[model samples]
Structure formats: C-alpha cells, structure tokens
Target: MAFLVVSRYSPLFAILFVASLAGLHCESPGKSPAFSFRFERFEKNRSLDAVIALYGDAEISDFVVGITRPAVFSSGRVVYRKPVRFLGRNPSFSTYFAFSVSSPDGGEGLAFFLAPSSSPVKESTNGLHFGLPPGATAVKFETRTEPETGSHIRVEVGGEISKQSSNLSNVSLVLHGGEKVHSWVDYDGDSKRFEVRLSKSSDSRPLSPLVSYPIDLSRVLQREEKLVGISSSSGNSTQTSSVYSWSFAVKRGAPYSMHSEPLDPRPFVVRARESPPIHLRRTYPWGVFVAMVFAAACGGLLTFFVMFVWFALIARRPVAPVEYPVHPVEVGYQQIELVAGEKGVDSTKK
Candidate 1:
C-alpha cells in the first residue's frame, strides 16, 4: 500500500516542479529589456543608482535632486547618468513628473530636456538660457512675463526658442503659485509626435494635452544615446523649484537602426557632410510649402474663371441675318408676228 501511494503522488510532484521552473524562466530579465524608474521621494543619504547631479545648486533634500535651493541668480540640474537606448527604429516613451515653484517675486522657472550625451550644462545669462544645451529639445514652464508673450508653456527643439504649438488657455496655470503641478510628456517615435499634458497633483491625467507637435528627434539627438534631465533657474529672482516625484519608461522591442543614414558623432559645426542645423531647415520648409499651396490655389481659380468667361461669351454671341442676291430677268418682245397680223386686219378694216 505504501509503494502504490508513493508512485501515484510522484507524478503530481513532478508536474508542480515543471510549472515552477516555467514561471521562473518567464520572469527572467533577459527576455524583456526596458528602461524605467520611479522616485516618489528623495533622501539626502540615499544613494541614487545611475543618477547624477550634473551641476549647479542641485541637491537632494526632502524631494528628488532636481529641486533648486532658494537663492537669487542660481540654477540646478539633475540627469540620469545612463544614456537612453532605443531597441527599435522608432522607440516611444512616457514620463510623468510633479514640480512646484515658489517665489516671492518673479521667477524664471523650470524645464525638462533631452539632449545628446556630449552636451554640457549651459549657465544662465541675463536670466535667459534655462540651462538647455544646443541641439536639445525642451518643454519650458515660464513664470516670468515677456514683452510679447506673457507667462506661457513653450516647447522648443534644436535650441531654437520659437513659439510652440499649444492652447492659449495654458497660460492660466500659475507657475509660481507653489502648488504641485503634474506633467506628462509622451513621445511616439513612429508618428514623430510629442505631446505634453498638465494638471494638478490631486487630479488624474488630463483628457487633452497642453501642447502637441510633430518632430523627428533622431535629427536632433544625433545618436542612439541621449541624456534626459530637468533644470531650473532663479534668474535674478529668489525662487525655489521642487520636484516631488518622477517616473519614466521606454517601450521595449527588437533593436533596429534609428535613421536611414548613419550620422557622424562629431559636432554639427565640424561635420562637413551633414546638412544645415535643424532650426534653419525646419523653419523655412513650412513657410515655403504654405506659400506654394496658396499660389497654386489662386492660379487655379483665376484660370477657371477666365475659361468660364470665354465660353459664356462664345455661347451668347449675336448672329447676323443672312442676305440673298436678287437676280434680274430679261423679257424678250414678240411684237413682229402680232404686228403683222394686226396690220393686215387694220388695212382690211380701213
């Protein structure tokens, strides 16, 4: 009886062992490689793995290290030490971060940027440059007012600070209010669309984004590796920019080349084979395309109008009445025979 029981239970034990092994294999890290991190809070003593305080007044306090200490004319930056790796030709990513800005007076504000690995942290000059390096793409939340555009959220690329595509109402969000604001930044590499959504920390993700634009980042980043970071500048005013939480994740897939043409790792200025910078290339093409489209439309309408008028005139032309010639008929006199007969009758009657 004991031997029979052992044989029957052995098969059940073997099945359970196989199932456990399969579960372990499925959970292995080698099958899926993804870059992701979430930091809800920060401690001064906690060592951040693969995180770097690149430069300037950036330190860990009660929050993550991107927060700048309250000081006038100061700036801070924090970046992930490892460069972002793309597993496919078109890699996508979504990031969410919460920040608050408090200032007694006006503030310069904060920014999130993506740049090439070789870029250096730029210092503020006359409260301008928000620590964004050249060839970087950034979304800036500005608290200070400008002569033309007041406090607004702007998305810029390739170091060109042009007015970005955004809803006008986004200006109502007070950047210096010191209230925690949540921001979501998403990029779809296949569609080349970049979007930004903003809301209060208490609320969930907004249904609509504050700004959305189309951009090909491969042209800007120039390589597979890129540095992602946050920066804030007091800019002649006393300000405190605090980041409470941050999360970032990249989609996983099979690896592929980023661009059709391989790019040289040298600086753009030194690359003789490369084309002109992105700002110059992106700005003119849209204007030229719009102008060409408008001109074609006008020409087509004008040609159509002229052809319609010509046809109408031809159809309504006055036709003259046709005239026929009246030919003359000659009458021959038959007087000789009648005269002879009448002469003979008149001589008899006389």
Candidate 2:
C-alpha cells in the first residue's frame, strides 16, 4: 500500500499533470482581416466546422491562409449564400483577390467565377471539371503529364459546358513541388479589364514572375451579380492537393495592379478595446490570486486529513504483549530426607 501510494504521487506524474493543465488552459488570439464569413477545417469532412459569419455591407479584404489536400470531393463549392451579397454598389476601381494551393501532385488545379445559382456542378479528377456555376467562366491551371511529352502547364477557359483550350505560349510561370504561390486578380470597372498574376520564389534571382494574363471581365460574366470563390480537387490516381489562403477586395477607384508588398505573415498582437485582458481588468488579478491561494490551502488541508486518518488507524490496532516469568532461588542448604516413620514413633515411645 505504501509502495502504491509512492508510485501514484511520483515526481514525473505530478510534472506531467501540471503541464497538461497549463496547456489546456492557455488561450490563443482570434482570427484577423475580418470577413463576412471565414471557415477552416480538414478535407475529410465537408462540413464547415469553424466559421465566422458577419452581417451588413462589410467587404472582406484579407485572409490568413492555410490548406491540406487529397480532399474527399473533387468539386468543393463555396457559395456565398444569399442574404450575403458581394459588390453591392458600383465601384470605380476593380477588386483584388488571391488564392494559393499546396499539392504533392501539382498536376491539377482550377479557379472559378461563380454566379447566383441554385445548383453547382463538380469538376473532374486531375483538373478535369472546373467547379463553377452554370453560365460562369472558369480558368483551369492544369499541370499534368502529356501523352507524348513531359509534364506541362495548360490553360483552359470554360463557360457552362463549352470549353476553350489554350496552350500557354509563354512558359514563364512554373509551379514547383511544395511551393507557396501568390496570385492576384484585379477587376477594373472603368476599363472593363481584368488581370491575373501568379508569383513564386526564385533560387537564382529575385521572386520569379509566374504568369500574368489580361482578362476581359465583360466577356467573362454573363451577369454582373455573381458570387465568386475558389474550388479544387485531386486526381483519380490518389494524389493530394490543398488551398492555403484567399482574399477579396472591392473599392471605388481606377482598375490598377500592384504587387503585394512582402510582409511577415506571422500573427501579430492586437489589443482589442472591448475585450481587454482579464488581468488588466480592475483588481481581478488580485482576486484570482486570493482564490488560488485559498484553493491550495484547502488541498493541503485535505491531504493532512487523509494522513491523520491513516496514522490513527495504525495507532488503534491491537498488539500482543510479551510475558516474562520470575523464579525465586533458595539459599545454599542441605536437604533432609525422612528414613521412615517408625524411627519417629520409637523416639516418641522412649
């Protein structure tokens, strides 16, 4: 019993318990670059587990990004469901947005220009079907093995069921394995012009420019009131793909393109006014300090009570006493033996 008690309260076990409690109690900062809606979850489940849905005419400009691949479904559509409208007002300048996906098999990728539709169709494996609403234009970024040659990048534009294939004449942009890509799209209302550019890292030189193409926005969308988002899937042969970050912007100004200034994508510390730190609120820290001290005192009292009970039981148990017998010793003397009773009788008669 003593051994069991000692083992249960070992130093290693105590340390592990305290460490786990600290980790479980620690909190992290909230999401940033606020949006109408934001969701981040694994690919295995199609449900949106973590989401922030905003109200009113607030435009979502920036997003902190991350994604994982070999998703279950090839056509994963994110529809900006109604009651949530985008580009409500006529703006002078074009909107800007970007998307990036990481894939072991970088063979298949697709981007969509979506509209208000009841039902959207899924894309095929290895970038076969570009997931888009009916009557919407889709730009496919395909990196697949050709029958007669090595791997190459091809661009395909589709609307509804019709598709137009175009071989990239300028092979400047090459997406490598496990690379973080930054691509942007600018929609200018004045010129009715749209431009898309993809950027990547360069080992020898500065950041290499992947591909830049001018798109005619007027020709692309059949209707002005359409919802837009990105969708991607994996190949039939068990390849994985993932999308990291996506951002959309809308403002009143001339349509112009600018390279995103490189900044540390690391999380920053922002002190929110409404939700201040608990420690900074009044004398709460002191109160918490007192509460913790009281709890510790109670715990110590409990431990002492248990120990007292244990010792009391040991004290009350019955124990056998040892006995010692004492023997008396006589002084040195000769012992007299009676010869016969007759000798005594004869003496009496005489």
Q: Say which candidate scores most in lDDT.
A: 1
User: Candidate 1, which segments miss by more than 4 Å at Cα?
Assistant: 1-33, 64-66, 122-128, 146-148, 162-172, 222-224, 252-350
Q: What TM-score does candidate 1 get on C-alpha atoms?
A: 0.58
Candidate 2 wrongly placed segments (more than 4 Å): 1-73, 82-107, 119-128, 147-173, 201-216, 219-224, 255-350
What TM-score would every model get versus the actual structure? 0.58, 0.43
In terms of lDDT, the poorest run of 10 residues in model 2 is: 49-58
* Whole-model lDDT values for every prediction: 0.63, 0.40
Candidate 1 structure quality by residue, lDDT tens digits, 66-130? 55667677787777777887555666776777888887688788889887777776454333466
**Per-residue CA lDDT of candidate 2, range 1-350, in tens?**
54455465556546645655664453222211112332322122223222322111112332222221344334444434432233323332222223444445443654545544433433222333434445555545554544443223333334532333333324445442545444544555445444445544332211323333444444333334445555544444223333434334343333333434432222111222333221111234665666566567557655755775586567566678988998998887655554457546322221
Top candidate (TM-score): 1
Q: What's the CA RMSD for each of the models? A: 28.1, 22.1
